[model samples]
Structures are given as C-alpha cells and as structure tokens.
Target: MSTAVHDHPHGHDDHAHHPSGLARYLTTTNHKDIGTMYLWFSFAMFLTGGVMALVIRAELFQPGLQVVNPDFFNQMTTLHGLIMVFGAIMPAFVGFANWQIPMMIGAPDMAFPRLNNWSFWLLPPAALLLVTSLFVPGGAAAAGWTLYPPLTVQMGMGMDLAIFAVHILGMSSILGSINIITTLLNMRAPGMTLMKMPLFCWTWLITAYLLLAAMPVLAGAVTMILTDRHFGTHFFNPAGGGDPVLFQHIFWFFGHPEVYIIAIPAFGVISQVIPAFSRKPLFGYTSMVYATASIAILSFIVWAHHMYTTGMPVQAQLFFMYATSLIAVPTGVKVFNWVATMWKGSLSFETPMLFAIGFLFLFTIGGFTGLVLAIVPIDIQLHDTYYVVAHFHYVMVAGALFAAFAGVYFWIPKWTGRMYDETLGKWHFWLSFIFFNMAFFVQHFLGLAGMPRRIPDYALQFADFNMVSSIGAFGFGLAQLLFLYVVVKCIRSGEQAPAKAWEGADTLEWTHLPSPAPYHSFETPPMVK
Candidate 1:
C-alpha cells in the first residue's frame, strides 16, 4: 500500500535495545533469534536421531541382535524415523524460512512475530516427550513411524506419549506454516510482487500451505488411535465394525504429502544455490513455480501408492499406479531446469554448490527408484523390504538433508559474518557423499535378496552387505560432526566475509545487506524495482 522507503540516518547501533542472554531467546520476537534457535535445536535432534540410527545399524551389523533386544531395536527404528522426519528435517527448513524469507522479500520481520516465537518453542517439549517416551514403562511406540492402528492400539503408555508428541509437533507445524504464509502474502516490500520474488520464497509459500492441509490429517489420524486405545472407539478396529485399511488410507494421505513437505523447501534451496553459483538467472522461473505446484497437488492423489500391498481393487491399484508415476513429469522439469541453469555458465564449486550438485545427482537416483516402485507389480515386491528403505533415504537424506546442508553452507557466512574453512567444508561434503552412498546403495541389493526392514536379525546371506552398511552409517554420522565443527569455527574465528559473500548471487539479501546482517534487517523497506 505504501511505496515509500524509510531512511534510518542514525544507523544500526543507535537502535539497539533488545534483551540479552537467555531472556532474549525466551522472551523476544526477533525472527533471527528464533531462527538461530530453530537451527541449533534441529541439529541437536539430528544428532539424537543419528545415534538411534547407529544403534539400528550396529544391531543389524551381523544380524543376531547382538547390541540390543528385539523390542528395543524396534523402538530405535520407530524413534529414529519420527525424530528425523518431524524433529530434524521439518524444523531445519522452518529455521531457514525464519532466517531468510523476511529478508529475501525485504520485510522487517514475519507477519506474526510472537506466533513465530511460540511455534519454535513448541518443538523442544515435543521432542523431549518423544525422547522421554523411550524410557517409559514398555518403551516408545514400536509399530513404526507410520503408527498404524491395530499395532498402535496394543502398545503401552509410551504410545500415549508419542500420540501427544505428535499433537504438539503438528500444532507447531501448523502455526509455523500459518506464520510463513501470512508473512509472504502480506509483508512483501512495495513493488515486489509475487512473481518477482525469489524462488525460495515461492517454495516456502507452497510448502506452508501443504503443512496447513496435511498436518491436520495427521492430527486426526493420531487422535483416532488415541481414542481407540482408551475410549473404546473403533475407528480402525474390525471387531468394532471398523476397517484397518481405513487407517492406512488416512495415515498415508498425510504421510505422502509429508514427504514433499520436507522436500519442496529443499527444492527451493537447491533452486537458489544452483543459480547463485552458476552466475545465471534461473532458466525457467515461471515453469519451476508451476512444476512445484503440480508436484504438491499430485502428492495427495498418490498416497495409496504406499499401500499397494495392502490389497485394493485392480482398478484402484491402476489409478494410483498411474498417479504415482505421473509425478515424475513435473519433477523432471525441475531437474532439467537446474541442469540448464548450469549449462555453460561460469560455475564455481563452492561448498554450497558441491552439496547442491550432490543433491541433484542423488535425488535423481532416488526419484528413479521411486518411479520403479510406482509400478504396482514392483511396489508389491518391494513394499516392506530394504529396497523401500533405500529409496526413501535417497529422497529424504539426499533430497532434504543434503539441500539443508547446501542452504547452511550457502548462507552461514551471512548469519555469522565469517567464512568457513573451505578445506573442512569440502571434507564434510565428500565424506558425507561417499559414506551416504555406501550405507544405502547396498540396501537395494539386500532388499532384492528379500531382506526385510524393521527386523533386528537377518538371514545369514545378508551378513556382508549389512556390515558394510553399518560401517558406512558410522562414517556418515561422524561426517556430520565435522559439519557442526565447521559451523562453530566459522562463528568463533573464520575469515571475514564480504557484504555479498558469493559474487554471483543476486537476491536482495545479498545485494543490499551487510555481512552478519544487522539485528534488525530492513527496518526500512527496500525498494524492489
């Protein structure tokens, strides 16, 4: 509504009156502070989940349940999936949105800043409930992260803890989503219309809506389980005249879109990194926007693809199979655009670009395997095997996690006002890339050999690959410590970075801001044109 840019002649130091120490984090509504907290919290959860994964890999190392009992092993698998998906990946992206979105769009802060604070604070207690559940009487929910009904109904008090945790996490997601959507829609600077905004902003706008729509479905699914367990309701009980298949329908309805909720933002990160490093404007910005929208829409109809082995009518199976495969079309458009952006441009291989490239190569492999799994016949074969496990890790680990690493490496200089050690950054990327492949690639073979997932012990024929995978898992986990070190070292004492750290970058945050962006950025709205 206002096309005027206010000037602050007194400069940054004159307006500094924010609180200090723990009180600042507890009681402030600053987007940057909340974002920093989100990033650190996500990293903590990532490490916690990584430890659980190592336990699973170690137990499966030689296939005898040597390290833990079968029951405990199941709990590790369940908790690892839940923490990584909800705690690690989702919050990490939200952190990036908090830090980057307002600045990118030239807004002073999120539209609902106090709600942003509340959204972030909600995560820790929910995460604590999840971690504490593992120690409660009878251990955490072990029916797997999908939390299917009948198995869920039979579990102990820990299951109740997990249900409550899900409710809290869902609330966090929904609130965060609403904040993001409101800020993007209402807070863009004058002259910066939606089409001219950066691709990252566009992706988050879509992702936030996806969260709003999908999280409620998850909340509903879990609530039914809570009622079935204690209130004698039969939402998923056959003897109570309900259908178990109904639970799968509802859970996967949320579950499948949940995959993109984690990934679409990753796509946004990669979209930004590729162009910044390539010294090019994005090749097809409009098409990229439309393709992302198409993928989100398609995510809803393809949920049943995860349930192919659960027995559906032939016609139902055919409809889902075709819908699932059709997703690749828009996904391919995105991939083609990334490669085209890099086509003969003056590309520099910075740490961020390295991770972005890794994301492209590995995420494509994941997508291809996904395409293979989309065929009803093939999915029926691979549904519960390690092949399914390998497929998603490629998508989630390489797709979301790798893109997150790219975003951090790309933007950390801005956040900290110092350059990271390139040597160590490269080391972190290469080690993670190598070990990641080592850990998951072999699982495809193990699955083809009929090695089942979620089991502590495997047949003797699966021994060698499992051991190799275990070694790789340990390596991948250790690589992340290098990442943590690099980030902290940068903050403490790395070289100073220029105001615009990357030469090829063109966004407003890069073009208009100083390094270590001021405590309050864009206190005066930036003119977009």
Candidate 2:
C-alpha cells in the first residue's frame, strides 16, 4: 500500500523474458527500458536533425541557392525545428527521467511501466510521418515550423501528415507526464520527503505538470487545423469569419510553455552537475523548486508575447510585454542559485562541470536577449528576423543541448561502469564551444541589420557573416563525431568505474547500487535507510 517495493523477493523463475509483441511496447509500463529507448531514439533524431541543419548550412555556405530551393529550405527549417524539439530534446530528457528518477527515489520502477513503454513507442510512428512526408507528393510541410495559417493552409499532403504527427506526439507526451507525476508523488523512498528530493526530480515534476496542461491545448489547436484543412472549419482563416490571429493565440498558448518544457529539465541537469563537481550541496534547493514552479505558472500567461507582431491591441501588447518580463526574475533566481552553489566550493572542472559552466554563461546571454526581445518596442524591430533566430538558438543549442551533453557525460560511467576518455571529451568540449559561438554570435548583428530568417538567399551585405557561420556550422557538426566515439568507446571497453563514480557526488544512486546496473535491476526494492 505504501508503493515501496524494497526487498520484494523473487525466485530466479520470477524472471522471464517479457512478451515480445507490438502490444508489449504499445502497452508497456516499465521505466528503465522506456527511458533507455527514449534516450537512444532521441540521439538518433538529433543526428537526423543535425543532418537537416547541415543541408541548411551547406546551401547557405555561399551567396546563392545551391543545395535546396526556397520551398525545400522552408521544409528543412520546419522539419528541423520539429525534430529537434519534440523528437530530440524532449525525448532525451524523458529518457534521462526513465533511467535516473526511480533510482534516485528508491522506487523499483516508474509508477506505471506499461504507460511508460506506450509513451516511447508512440514516438516512432509520429517521427516516421514527419520524416517520410518529404518524399510525398508536394513534399513535407513548408509552412515554417510554427505552421502559421494562410501559409499552412496553402501547404499540401505534408501538412496533413505533420498535423497528425503532432497529435500523436502530444498524446505521447501527455501520457509520459502522467506517469512521471504519479511516480514522484507516490513512490518516494522512505525518508526521502518532498524537500529531500533532488532538484532534478523537483524540476521534472513541475515540467510534467506543464506538459499535462499545455500538450492538451496544442492537441486541440492542431485538431482545429486538421478540421480547417479537411472538415471546412474556419478557426484560423479570416476570410471565412475566423481570425488568423486566433490561430497564433491558440498555438502560442501551447508553444510558450513548450519552450520551458524543453528547458527546465536542462536547468535540473545543471543543478545536479554543479553540486557534484563543486563538492557542495546544492544551494537553496527549496528555492530552486519553487522557482521552477513559478516559471511554469508564468509560462502560461506569457504566450501572447510571441503574438505581438500579429496586430494585437495596445493594451494586450503592454500586458504581455510586462508579464513576459516577469519571467526574468525567477530565471535570474535560478542562475544566481547555481553560481552560489559553486561559490567557494573546491571545484574540479570535470567534463560535466565544464559544460555546466558553459551553460551558465551562454544561457545568461540568451536570457538577457530574451528580456530584450520581451519589450514591445525591441520585438517590433527584431521579430521574424535573424536576431530572433540567433536568440533562441543560443538558448536551445547552446543552453539546452550543452547541458544535455553534460548530463550524459556525467552519468555515462554509472550507466556503463566504464570511464570515458577524458582527453577525447576535452576535444569535444572546446571544439563545440568555440565553433557554436562562432556560428551564432555574429548572427545578432545580421539580424539587427535586417536580415530575415528562413530565406535561402540573402543580400550582399549579409554574405560574409553567413559564410563565416556556415563554416562554423560545419566545424560544430563534425565535432560531434567525437562525442559518438567517446560514448561507444566507454561502452565497449574502457577504464573500470566505481559505484560512487565521482568523489563529490552525493545521491541515493551513489549510496547504493553497482556500476553497469544489472539488466533486471530493482526487482527487489532498494533500501534507502
């Protein structure tokens, strides 16, 4: 009744191969395997999306169109955004949840294993639809990833496929959220009170709640798009008594929160890494949890910020501008807390900590630009331009992706019981850091100078910066092969690792369990006392 499964003994016969059928995954509820699947699938999607980015960069390497036309360029951006957000970043974090959460909480598995598996399996089909649409007649969706109507309405079969794919992916996210909330709420190990839980779990709990609330709204909005396309409703079409602006309102209602949904987990990952490498307890853990919750609450109200360019009245614009700015306060608190956690602590710059420090500086730069964009006046000039493009990529690629890689490197030893090559890791970090900045930093000037986003070609003045960015892009892309090598080498054969992989690390995970956890881990509950 307590939902604590510690010492739940079973004979060897209790272990049998789980049934292998489509139904096994369609209805799976296991946490570890589901988490593993999510992470690997996300890595694959990252590569796929990266390839799309490479195509974009290759075309832009010169002054004119080369690899793709404007239409195909549009498709590449749309699909790239979709895959990286839903397919890569989101799934990677969820995968981390599957592997780490139960272990941290001392639970045998997630609250609902079948639901866990179901959430992961649903993703493949959804991803397939989005990818395969490129080969379909009239090609994949070319309406920008936002799928802003009028343009979206003009799209062909690919739009329909993307719409359905969104629905499927949303369903998957909603289900995963439910499982995470249930597990955290119901399955904490004895003595692990809510306050005692790590920031990673706390941040995830708030994120899951946001997902539960916002994904449904996205599903509903896309449902309307589907109806408009096939069933003749005018929810987003102004010519038919509906408002195109209404579509943006509805989409951003979901879209704004979705940004935090991807980011908050990265914050959690950094929270874990900073403390581990800095040799101290996380500073202000309670405040961090409350701050995350506050961010989620604020996310819902700020949806209109993305819609300021859509001709909202002055009152709406002013209200949204101020409300969006409020987010900076809570975000500021989180940033301050991380630095404080590291203050005066004996720190070693491990691979994980290196990325965390990188995240701190880069994410702050990103947050500052976000505040700049939050102002109605600044946004009026910057919106829909490369400045906006530069801003979000700084946050997403530099902020989120960097933290994710840090988390992966920090935990790889525990997961595989082998230490990765540190020299190789250093190579991966420096190359990525320098080139990522090189690729994106100059774009701020281009955007300010009035270069628009999503264009396959640009004016002569923009040529030099675009060429530099493209070269940096290739450098960043090729550098990831180092990451792939490090992971594979560790998994295959590397230096043996200990149970408490890092000297400064303190968690329920380090207190118990061996490296390279057995295939059938936690069949009996782990004792937390």
Candidate 3:
C-alpha cells in the first residue's frame, strides 16, 4: 500500500464554502455533517425509548398495577418498540453508513446529497408526532408495535398519529436507502472492484435493498389501518367481513425482514472490527458476502413463522418452521468466520473488539432462542410471552446496539481526530454488557415460567425476576451516559489521532485519508490498485 496523498484536478476550493454552527447543520449537504446529525438524533431517541422501558419496569417492579394503568403500559410497550427500532437502531446504522461508506469506497459523497439531508431532517418531526401523541385524546397507540387491526382501530387519535409516523419513517428510510444503493453502485474509486470493497460497504448495500423491499409493505399495512379507522373500510374488521389475521400477514411480511435489516449491518461492523483487532484478513470474505445475501433472501420466506400461532395449516407451519430455522445456517457461518478470524491471531482487547466479542456471544443466544421459537409447537406455547421479549432485546440491544457502540469506538478516532479515554471506554462496555444481560436474560426464565408480555402487572411467581430485570434496566440506562461522556470528551480534548488509527486497519479510509477526514474527502477518487 502506498502512503502518498493525491490532489484532484478539481479541488476543495471549487466546492462551495460550508456554513458554520447552526447554519452548517441545517443547510449542509456534507455527508459528515449529516452523519453527525443522524447519530445525535438516534441517541436522543435511544434515551427516550430507554425512559419508556424504565416506566414499564417501574410499574412491573411489584405484582399488581403500581404506577401506570394498563392502557398506558400498553402505550409504553408499543412506543418503546417503535422508537427503538425505527428511530434509534436504524438511524444509527445509517449514520455509520453516511460517514464511512463514501470514505471506504473512495467516493466523494452520497449519490444524492440534498436527498440525504432531507431524509435525516424528516426523522425529528416524525419522532415528535410519536411522543406528542401520548397527550392526545386517548393516548399513544396501544396496539403492539405490530399495529394489529382491531386493537389499532379501537384506539383514539394516537393511532392515527402512529400511522402517520410510520409513513414518514418509511419515506425517510426509502430515500436513505436509495442514496446508499446509488452511492455504492456508482461511486467507487478508479480500480476498486466490488469484491475489493470493505465488508462494511457490502453490508450497507444489502441493507439498503432490504429497506427498499420492506418499507412499502409496512407503509401499505399502516395505510390500511388508517382507512379501517376513518373510512368505512373493513380491511381488518372481521364483523365487516375482513380478517384480522390478514394484518399479521402484511405486518410480518415487513416485520421479519426488519430483523435482518438491523442485524446484518451490525454483522458488517463486527466483520470490520474483529479482523482489524485480530490483525488478520477477514476469513471467507466471499462466503460472508454470499451468506449475507442468502439471509436477506431467506428473510422474506420465513416471515410466516411469526404467524405460527395464528393457525396456519400444518403443512404451512412446517414449511415456515423449517425456513425460519434454516436462517441459522448463514448466521452460523458469520459467527464461525469471526471466531476463525480471531483464532490464534495476535488479538487485542480494545473497547471495539470487546463489544464485537459481546455481539458474537450475545447475538448467538438470541439466534438460538429464535430457533427454539421457530418450532411451531414451541412458538404456539411461547408466543406473546416474555420469552419473545427476551429473545429480541438480546438480538436488538446486544446484536445491534452493542455493534453500534463497537463501530463508534472503532471509528470515532478517525471521525474526530482524537483518542477517547480507553479506561472509560472499557468501563462503559463492561457495565453495558453486564447490565444488558442482567436486564433481558432473566426474561427468558420468566417466559419459560409462562409470564405474558405487554401487561401492566404479573402474578407473584414472576415477581423476583422482574425485579432483577428492572434493576438491570436502570443500570443499563444510566451506563449510556458514560458513552455520551466519552464521545464528548474525545471531541473536545483527547490526544490527537494519527492517519491510520489502528495498526491492522487497512481500508481506504484508514490507509489513504488523514485523521479527522477532510470535509471534502475523495475530492478526486484515489486509485485502488
């Protein structure tokens, strides 16, 4: 690899001057600025969702209703799921894509800069609609985040608000996906082939396509809910000759693919971080790409697994069960590849690597539980139980959130040109890792004991684990402040970082760019060979 810097024939001076302060963020089309906004906004939503989780935990701290009423409890559960999935996890990954994708592939910027800005700006308003709906005539949507028809139709104006929020979120996701797909397909450097691109870029390309395919199904489902509520439509009203189960079909069609949308990108982050820390080229790179694509394709077929209890025919149930369980094969390949990448290599326990290892360990637990749920009889027994809740948080929090933290720690040095306090970073990781398990792991036991989810209160037998889970939830919530502190402290006054922050980091961003990548990176695309 060469260590030379090349200037483009058309340079930064030809580009318009970027505005400073508020104007910079509000009017900028710069990918870095837009990426920063996406990150901050997602963190805000993470805190909001975390608070809702605490409220639910607080009410469930003891047997019998103690704090919120059942309706409000339902609202808390619904909003917590919606906000965390749409606002926090999805956008955080998009933020990473915006900041790293262009640099990784040696592109000047996202394919559509103004559309990128519009996509980010759409989020806050949608989030506001969701939060403010709690104050509306009947409170926020109490139907689970799935927004099933009958319960959704029974809700007040808040359901409408939630419906609209989903629409806006879908639009933003579609637009963002378009930008990512276009950028990856059209803007690589002179000689960088698709196979030569970093794993992170490859993951985002697949995720962007998943978003495009899935968001419309969600949008259509919500639109039907809206019509059933206001217009004289019976799309889901059984009394009006519509089947409520149809809503499940549509929602899961979008919902199941959504699981991979969140997890695959996290897989990408771990794929990058593990090899860098272990000082090895990624094991089975071609196979990893094929495995990721296979997972995405399989996602569409396996969605009916979520509907096993909705009473499909035995043959359909068996097919779904088998298809759902088969996802493990590719997912297993990814996990094995990461472990093999680190096997007997010169490994370091940097904060990033720690979180990658945590993602691997915890996400596998989530995956195994998913396999258990895929068995039709087992799902019939455990559907809508705390077991389901426990399973997803393991995947979402440990899988996506842990990987996001790893990406942040791994790349923040390059983003900010400063080293974060290693001591604080490690502390943040351990506290989060321990408390995250503490909070959700026990729910698996509670579910096996037959504790139902989405209820305000539970029977006495489930009391102890719920208490432990609540305490863990609070600890997990508070530990995030330490992450905030580390990010801020690094931005403000940490030691300066070098061009290639990690010795094993070999991508274009690390090898070809300076610390704190220039505002106009790849003003001229670098030669890849």
Candidate 4:
C-alpha cells in the first residue's frame, strides 16, 4: 500500500501548480478544497443561527418581551431552526463526508467531484435567501421551520423565499447523496469491501439513502405550501377543500427521518472516536451496522408519533406509540456497544474523548426524553411545550453537534497537520458542557409547568427559570469562540502533528497517509489486505 511516509505537514505547498486564493475554492473540484469550504460555511451559519437563538433566549428571560417583539421573536425562532438544521448541522456533517470519505476508502476523490463543487456552491445562495427574508416587508416566514400550514399560506413573499431556499438546499442534498452512494459502491480500492468499510462510511452511506428518499418529500411538502401561498391551491387550506393535517403527515414523513439523518452520522463519529481513545476495536461492529440500518428503517414508521395530539384514531396513536418505542432498542444497542468498547480499556480524556463521552451521556438523556414523549398520554401533556424543546436540543446539540466537535478535535491533526491547544480544548469542552446543561436543563421545568414554545413572552411563574436559562445560553454561546480559537491556533502556529496522531487510529487515512494529506491523495489506491 505504501513504501514510506512523506513529510507533507501543514501548508499544502505540493500544489503551487494548483490554483490559489479565491480561485482555488470557487472553481476547483478537489474533494479536500471543497470540504474546507463546506466547513467554513457551516461554522459561519452556526454563528448566524446562534445569534438568533440568543435573541430568543433574551426575550424569554423576562415576563414581558424585553428584547424583540412577538413577531420578531417568531422570525428569530423560525430562522434559527432553518439555519441550524439545514445550514449549520447538516453541512458540518457533509463537510466530514467530503473530507473523509475519499481518504478512508482510498479513493483519490469523490466519484462526482464537479457535482460536489456545485452542491456546496448551492448553500450560500440558499442561506442568503433565508437570512435576507428577515428584511423583507413581512419579515421572514414566521410559520416556523416546519413551514406549517395556514400561517404559511397567509404569509408574504418571505415565505416564498424560504420555500425557494428549501428547494435549492434540497437539490444540493440530492446531488450529494448520489455522489456519496456512487463513490461508496463503485470506487472502493481493490480489497476494501463494503463490510470492511469504516463505520463512518457505512453510516454516511445509509444517511445518503435516507436523504435521497426524504428530501424529495420535503421538497414536495414545501412546494405545495408555495402553491397554496401564491398560486391559490388548497393543498393544506381547508377553505378550498384541503386538510392541514396533510401537511403534518408529509412534513413529518420527511422530518422524522431527518432526525436520524443528523443522528446516524453522529453515531458513526462516536463509533470511531470512542474506540480510538479506548484503545479497542469497536464492540459488536457487525451488530452496530445492523442496528444503524434498523434505526434508518424504523425512522419511517414513527413519524406519526409526532402527530398523536392532532386527533388520529386511538388505534393509530397506539401503533405510532409502539413503533416509536421500538426505535429505542437499536439505539440502545449502539450505546451499549460504545460503552462496552470503553470498558476496562486504556481510556484517555483527550478533548475528542471528552466530547464523545459527553455525547454518550447527554444524548442518552435526550433519547430517554424522546421515549417519555413517545407515550400518547404523556405527549398530549407536553405537546408544543418547552419539554419538547429541551428534548430536541439535547438530541441535536449533544447527538450531532457534540459528535461534530469530537470529529473535528479527533481529525484536525490530520486535516491541518498541527496539534490543537490541549488546555484550551478542554476548556472549550467543559464550558460547553456546563453551560449547555444550565441553559437547557431548566427548560424541562418550564415545559412541565405548561409554558408553550415559540412564544415571545411567558408568565411570571416561568421567570426565574427562564433567567437562569438565558444566562447559561449566553455562556454556552460564548464558549464556542474558545473552540474557534483552539482550531485556528492549531492551524496557524501549533506544533507539527505526526502521521498517526492518535495511538489507536486505524483507518487508512491514519495508517497509510501522511499528516495534512497530499493534494492528490491516493495517487495509487492502497490495497486493504
């Protein structure tokens, strides 16, 4: 596979022959170049969305609206959801795919590199459409990120912009899925079979298929809303022979799978980061694979659990309750396998491992809350309340965002050829962990007290808890700046990283390639066995 290691550290000067500056990014089809752009773009969106969240939190801090008005608050919530889900979290994981997939599988680049370039280029314009909607006469789509029925129909051109953004984003996602599927199936090196692929690759492969199946459904849902808003169709408007429940059905059909589309990649990241720090092979690898596929398959049937309060028949409620409950089994399997991998092994609390263990702890909490909400009666009590909000943040922040943190810390050495500040890295993790809990943990109380979500103001009874949550929210948001510093410091002036930075990193990227991989990676595909 490799005769000797080359010292290709830090600056990728091997390709002075390659284009530089803005030209390198705009027109280049190289996987790593495109990957870097995707990451930077995602971080920019994360900050953009984080600001919206802070605005929402600030308003909720007091009984009367102190920061933004009711309408503005809705805009913040709506834009925050759209930006985080579509613009921040999803793109971060796709950045990982663009960077890691080719290297892990010993392919020179993605099978469809030009398509990769085009897919990433689609995001910024979509983001522009979303953010710019705020300045429009109607002040963005206030019907919430779900773009739910009658409100969307009544909204102004802002809703149309949001709809068009969704369309562009969906097209980007569809193209990405096709590229990933083809690359995985048709481009593995001589001996790297499907079963032998890294768990991250396996997870992404499944996620790609989920994207392929679900994106069009979301596109259709939003398109119908667009027609209702503009062309006077009644797909979801009751006055014109339509049912609003139809929107929920179609949205959740795509939406529930979207949860796992974010999660399963996280599952893959934890799978890798945990075992490497534990100095053990991942426990029950085969079963982990099957479990992941099971989760993806189960995601389809459980969409109705989210709709139970909308007056589905009791039988349908029971069916969804049971179906949603069944997902916990495979999820529990993945968690069990991760914990088992760390049992009695040489564990180290590197920043990556700290983030992984945090993911294990909090994501489990989210999963438990998810189970609690799966019960029909319990969900009826908590619907549209802060409890649902708390549960979702735990899942998305811990499940996907924490795992993304771990992956960045784990692989930044490879990507940048320099070591991150260990001290600052730990600080980043601890600050994030403590403040995140402080911000969100109290929201559970607010929800149980019957405070509804998506509101600008709350009753005085929810006051003290909301204040604490806001303070914590501010702290948590500030902690991310430390993360940014750690990464930038590593890249600009940190110590040089060796080829194998982690003692137990066993993937082809670590074992067969040098640090800060060469521009033309795998000029000759490394044989697996």
**Tens-digit per-residue lDDT, 50-93, candidate 3:** 99999999998889988989999999999999999999999999
Best candidate, TM-score: 1
The parts of candidate 3 lying over 4 Å away from their true place are 1-16
Q: What TM-score does model 2 achieve against the real structure?
A: 0.96
TM-score for all models, in order of appearance: 0.99, 0.96, 0.98, 0.97
As for TM-score, the candidate ahead, 1 or 4, is 1
Q: Number of clashes in model 4?
A: 0
Candidate 1 residue-wise lDDT at 526? 78
Ranking by TM-score: 1, 3, 4, 2
Best by lDDT: 1
For model 3, state the Cα shift of residue 88 in Å.
0.2
Q: Which residue window of length 10 is worst by lDDT in model 2?
A: 7-16
- For candidate 4, lDDT tens digit of each residue in 382-443? 99999999999999997899999999999999999889999999999999999999999999
Give candidate 4's whole-model lDDT.
Answer: 0.93
Ranking by lDDT: 1, 3, 4, 2
The 10-residue segment of model 3 with minimum total lDDT is: 3-12
lDDT by candidate, in order shown: 0.94, 0.87, 0.93, 0.93
Clashes of 2: 6
